[model samples]
Target: MEKIERGKALKTGRDYEDIKFRRKVFMSKCVKKAMSLFRIVTLIGISYIVLSPMISIISRAFFSESDVYNAMVYLIPQNGTLKNFKLAILRMDYWKTLGYSLLYIGSLAILQLFICSMVGYGFARFQFPFKKLLFGCVILTIVIPSYTIMLPLYMHFRNFDPLHLFGLLGIGAKNWLTTVKPVY
Candidate 1:
């Protein structure tokens, strides 16, 4: 039935094909336009949601310290300035912290994805003793909160001192940031 209409369309004077193609182009254009709008709206919404608080904070930071303190009691300040930025930079070292956070998060994501894919492939393809148990353990680890191990991890790292290894690598495990020597 569809084929017959297409056949008749082909026979007709460019009406069916032209109309069909135009309709397709129109639909495609509409879809693309809608998608573009959606992307823009989504981006704007996300930016507004994320940046509004930061903007408010930044504005407040520009006010006189006394003014800022007073404003905090009521509504936030509208003023903005370099003093707050300078003070913030001196105190927090924003760039360094941001870099560390990015590196940590990026490494964790890559490691998790790689390990999951490899382990999933192994579980899907291979048979081993207590395989289900091992998989369950992996799943459990994923679900369990990492905050639970904070103190244990802190203690482990604190206690972990490599006598010769530190000298060889020119790195003390205590401070990774100050090390000029690469870890071996």
Candidate 2:
């Protein structure tokens, strides 16, 4: 057996092997430390990105009108007030607005959840004609931007006529957008 000394050239095969093993371990430790540091930096950056808008909005909500206009006050308002919240509640008709919003959004979310689940289950379990085409159409809908279809949808709903059936029946086109029928 040969004794290995730090910062000294290897005198035997055993010493060389020992030095190589030590070098490998040292390199692995350095790499691990570097990776951990990198991970911490990346997490911090992501946290900042996600939280920055929320922090700004919360800070701004507390700011007075004058504080908002003042150039000296940036993130933290010099003087904070609840007047903004009071004004918002008054102007928005808090209870009625909240009720309507909850009714509309909650109904839509519940209906969408059930509808999507049923559709997904059908897709998974069924073997039907034109399934591929139907799936392709679904994919196409997902791929297409909502804004692209918004104009056509708006126009259709504004003067909703189904294949001129209303014209044949002598019933005039009803504006779906004007009525609350579309909400249901």
Candidate 3:
């Protein structure tokens, strides 16, 4: 080995290979650490964004009315009370409201599930005309923005006269806006 030392003891063969190996190892470790730190920060930021609203709502529920007017009150209320909770439950008749809501939502969910399952079964068991096209449409609906169809749907329901049956009875296209008939 020729001893040439301007700064580092520049090595040849095995020593130089070892230095290269060490550099590669260090670089890999640094990259791994950077990636992990990035992932942790990303997760934390997303979690905060998703959870902060729920946290704020729950925190506010625990707060007294005085806390709302107080500028100093923040995440934790200075004087907390269950009055808000009690008043809401009492005024709304919480149990009855919850029961009705759950019944309505559950029935809708079950009906939707049943209809989807029947459609799926029909698709799987039968080979009908334009089957592929229909399936493509079904799949496409998942990707399509709902708002794209909303205007057409709104217009259809807005001027719904169903075979001119209502028109025969001297009634014109009925505006079914905000009516429960459209829900069905």
Candidate 4:
């Protein structure tokens, strides 16, 4: 049967199904577009949140001493200068310090990667005595604050001695605090 609307005849069976299918397709397209937009906006917001600190630090680096002291200035500097960078390099031996820091950090990173990889492999492939306890200890170390272990570390390095050899030789305890060993 055909239906007459606005002086136009509309097919009732196959045409009706075709119309419904087109509407559904159009609605699905709109929904997909909206979801894509929402995802893009969300990711952009997260990226900004993650990058804001680095942006703030980089902007602050251009500020002069006066600009730093001024309560009115925050992000935009009135008297921008590279004086801070120059002072850090010349007066504070920044290059030497940076090189040493990079070396120390790089070594530590490599060591950590190797050690963690081995431990992960062991956990994945093998079963050992105290396996659960060891895993729990590792997790506990990750969950707990490093500050809790600071006292013990300080005490150990405050007068570092081994096998009582230093005491036997009358050399006394050697303080490792002055070295970069404890800083890591």
Q: Each candidate's lDDT (Cα)?
A: 0.76, 0.90, 0.91, 0.89
Per-residue alpha-carbon lDDT of candidate 2 for residues 1-184, written as tens digits (9 for 90 to 100):
5565678876778777887899999999999999999999999999999999999999999999899899999899989999999999999899998999999999999999999999999999999999999999999999999999888888867878899888789998878787888776
Q: Write the per-residue lDDT of candidate 3 for residues 1-184, one digit (tens) a residue.
A: 4544678765567878877888999999999999999999999999999999999999999998899999999899999999998999999999999999999999999999999999999999999999999999999999999999999988778878889988999988788876888667
Q: Stretches of candidate 1 above 4 Å error?
A: 1-64, 78-83, 86-104, 151-184
Scored by TM-score, the top model is 3
lDDT value for model 3: 0.91
Report the lDDT tens digits of candidate 1 across residue range 1-184: 2344533435665666777888999999999999999999999999999998988775666676667667354345444457878888889999999999899999999999998899899999999999999999989898989999867776665535567577568675454324654332
Candidate 4 lDDT tens digits, 1-184? 3443675655557877877888999999999999999999999999999999999899899998898899999889999999888887999898899999999999999999999999989998998999999999999989999999989988876988889789999999989788987665
**Cα lDDT over the full model 4:** 0.89
What are the models' TM-scores?
Answer: 0.41, 0.67, 0.76, 0.60
**Model 2 steric clash pairs:** none
Sorted on TM-score, best first, the list reads 3, 2, 4, 1
Q: On a 0 to 1 TM-score scale, where does candidate 2 land against the true structure?
A: 0.67
